[model samples]
Target: MCKKGNEVDKDLHSLQLKNFMGLLVPHQRQIHAFILYLVVNRADADDILQETLVEMWNKFNEYKDGTNFVAWGLTIAKFKVLQFIQKSKNYRFHFDPQLLELLEHEAIRKNGVHTHNERVEILKECVSKLQTKEKVMLDLRYEKNLTFEGISRQFGVSVPAIYKALGRTHARLAQCIKLTLEQRGVA
Candidate 1:
């Protein structure tokens, strides 16, 4: 009986490891690329990717077997992206229209098999030019998708303050985006 119990435990451990390795091994690059595309910076993407992987590992039990692994992993990645965006001070500065376009393209490509690598590259250039505060505000409003009330709660300010911040941030971002687009000959 003791021997049988030991064998069962060993087998379960092996199976769990195998499941984890299997999920991570094949999807790691894709997941990283998706994260990079969202965050538009190599370092931030790397951090978020690590966080996503850790989250996936911790929540592995919640994943249903024999399901779409990429989708599951991407879902986890999305959550991590949102978390990173919320916490990151640099996110506001890095919000590029090109990045936004690339993310949108990626969503469509997932269903139809296209690529937005060039768009992502362009986005990186655009994001690099934003003012620090503008970048942070953009990250808070758009990337994190925080509502005025939600943002107000975060800073313990009034909802109107959040709205004013967003308005000012948007104005700056819009100007930057327009200049970027014009320079790129897209406008």
Candidate 2:
């Protein structure tokens, strides 16, 4: 009974992760851009974006369906930006705190986030550029929702091998997407 309960909990967590990723990926670039705008440093923006994503995932149960994912994410991102700013004594802001607050409120009110169809197209192209094995790995893990252990068993490899391969593939795709976005003057 304990084993069965553990299995059920694992399955539930997996489902929640899948659902969260489905909602998160499409808005990821937008959230990053917002962070960049607030922080004014690519490295700082990246760190804040990571923090914001973790917070969003942690509080995902509070998110409502059929609502504004970008707006919700931006609220979290704004808080993260402020938190980071407060923490970093060396960081300097071009605008005052009042202006920053106004910008955040106005952005939310205007719903300035735009859908990145071009990003989707670029991502598809990038995925197509991957090697056959890499493509299959991504499909199995993401599209087929296979865990690392499951993928390893299917591919006759160790779980760490599968994990490393997926990590490398993810990094490659992220670089590809970012480069493509820059080339298109979208980033």
- RMSD values for the candidates in order, in angstroms, are 12.2, 12.7
lDDT of 1: 0.73
Over 4 Å off, model 2: 1-3, 105-113, 118-187
Q: Please, what are the lDDT tens digits per residue for candidate 2 over residues 136-164?
A: 99989889989899999999999999989
Candidate closest to the true structure, highest lDDT: 2
Give the clashing pairs for model 1.
92-135, 92-136, 93-135
TM-score for candidate 2, residues paired by index: 0.56
Candidate 2, overall lDDT?
Answer: 0.83
Model 1 misses residue 187 by how many Å? 24
TM accuracy, model 1: 0.51
For all candidates in order, the CA lDDT equals 0.73, 0.83
lDDT of 1 at 146: 86
